[model samples]
Target: MSGSPYAPHTASETTAMLDAIGVDSEEALFDIPESVRFDGEFGIDAKSEQAARRAVASTLADNDDLTEFLGRGHYDHYVPSVVDHLADRSEFITSYTQYQPEVAQGFLQALFEYQSMLVELTGLEVANCSMYDAATALGEAATLAERLRSISGTRVLVPDLLHEGRRGVLDNYVAGSDLTVETYPTADGNVDREALTEQVDETTAMVYAENPTVRGTIEEGLDTVGDLADEHDALFTLGTDIVALALLEEPASVGADVVVGDGSALGLGSAYGFGLGLFACRGDRELLRQVPGRLVGASEDSDDRRAYTLTLQTREQHIRRERATSNICSNQAWVALRTAMHVASLGPDGLVELANDSVRRARETAGRLDELTGVQAPVHDRHHFREFVARVDQPAEAIAADLEAEGYAVHAVGDHEIQVCVTEANEQALDGFVAAVSEVVR
Candidate 1:
């Protein structure tokens, strides 16, 4: 509908409007308090379009064949050409907000498929279209955490090993929403389950944590936390890397009341580009009603024809603002479709094989690295997904710098740990990575 939201403004009209607003120039409108604004714009010269392209190409000229070795939250994976081709189909690419529900059935149906995929993956009773990403989804989940509880359950518990950015975003979302946010400390870069239990009580709204934590160490025994939240009537929300769930236990089976996670590992190219919302629950009917975003349902039209349509979309943008469950009904549909393709490409059995391959490769990589004189993951012993953190003899960042200089792409995750991510497409790269790491540490 917003074919061009800014089509009303012409260049000359914008200038005239600025002048009428009493600003000397467009730049003058940016005049902020000096304490907040830098005096200079870093003095970078602008280039012509052609010159810019050449300059950008030149910057990357020396690095055409470098193998990537980094995997913190994002990793390199094989995406089907069909994924892009299908997502770019005019039916999906040209559409937005299918409000009429009839004329917009194509987009709505694609979104419905996306939602169904998430339900299958998460094993929850229901999954909506999506949210901004796993982080914002968690923030929304935090709000639901409070709303799901009574006055006694007012505090939210976060694990020490939760992704820092996700935690910060959660804090900001709930700052004015009347809930206390606190992080449980870790024992060895992993959330201390004992500490988590000690703090969570009747006053706690949700016990939020991750497995295969940001520290690259898996947090054990969430069954205990779920039991605790049960006793207190609080929700036990497990945050996770969705792909890891293929190799690890599903949170539902392991005692989580709510399952929230970023599905980027499914196919998101980078952490910031696109995000997947992994939402599931213990399948409570009342609990499912309050869940946010788009919901797709398999239904029969009045004529008794089978169809899929957008279901419980209570987003403010779709419904009355006061009655809206979330303003995020239109989340990651195209992206979720990509995730679905990746998952469907790897069928349930295929997913298990991929998961096993990743776990084995990571374990092998750790074992080989630990054999080196100065590289090891001190915290790695449990089964892992594709990524694992290894402690180097020197600071991990410095070692990473050295590795990158040698045309390697390893990422530093902590003061002393570098992460290695293994995938089906990166076997040769992984071998080169191990050899390169050997030389660097040696």
Candidate 2:
């Protein structure tokens, strides 16, 4: 046997396996080009499991413990202990997509509740269990719009201030198709209605705008945008922050045909890379049929007892490739479960209060930072939710770097603009955050 404890087989066994594969040597089995293959021994020396764990832990401990104020697409939010406690259960954490409804009733129910919650929040008729993230959800929304025969257009119009990541993903999603992505101008930190009206034409399939824009300015005139979309016979896709939705007006109220956003703000505290995409649409049958991801529905079993099951699975795995609404094969069930638990725990009143508190902190912090001579309170003169842009005298990067050195993390959105995000979790850190900005500016 190999001396390494991690090795799964003896040397003799490996040689026998190679022989069975008709390869004389292990190196010969690999198809890697000889010119690029490594000739030297690996630098990592094998260590005991415990020693390896300790080494990794020690190295991770060296990372700076920075207080976060960053938010462009991601935010640092407080996750209630109950949310983690319930979501971390082995059953929920390890479970994959609930393929078998009988054994997956609990997960299906949770996801159904998640869909219901999103429907309520967005004022849409139906919602899917989950998507990869907000960016991907937006891409799916565009693709779904393109599929609708009534909305016969080959272009998707996006706000100029849309997050670059989301725009990039949209570009990639439509790259292989006949769709063309274009940007509408923004004025005073909101989508310029005149420009949008001028740009949207018979060639436009969908028009998307973020409520709380990437620059952290609350978008105004959503109803007007919707009207413009109607004039062009284009779908109005509204992208928003779920937490802010607790306090902001429903997209459907403003005539949104589709809603797409991140659900992570509820309780999925920043894992940086992980997020849950929230998607919902109007009650139209055609719209529901085109929505991506999986949908959980409550129904009566053969015994006439109440039960939950996967109702409409439109992804490639469930349906034929030619008819699948989306190629996405997986859903964010665990993250959606966490979101459901968190939203249920907060209830309606608590969610509204949490959103209000976040806005309060953003405004208070902006006011305090504005007191500094070199900084403007908010880059835009509109109400903001969890984040705001602070126009500083120094280069935004330098200010952000200095703040980082002092153990705080903030986003530099422009040459002289720093986007600061404040959530309920950062309530106690607000003053310290403002003080850090003051010091950095000085």
**Winner by TM-score:** 2
Looking at candidate 1, what is the lDDT of residue 244? 74
- Local accuracy of candidate 1 as per-residue lDDT tens digits, 203-292: 888778777676556667767777887788777788776677776766776677777776767765544336776776655766666777
Instruction: State model 1's lDDT.
Output: 0.72
| Candidate that would win on lDDT | 2
Candidate 2's C-alpha runs over 4 A off are: 1-49
Report lDDT (Cα) of residue 138, candidate 1: 86
Q: Per-residue alpha-carbon lDDT of model 2 for 243-346, expressed as tens digits? A: 88888878988889888888887768888758888888986888767777788888888899999988766545556587788887767888888888999999
Off by over 4 Å in 1: 1-66, 149-151, 271-273, 314-317
Mind sharing the TM-score for model 1?
0.82
Clashing pairs in 2: none
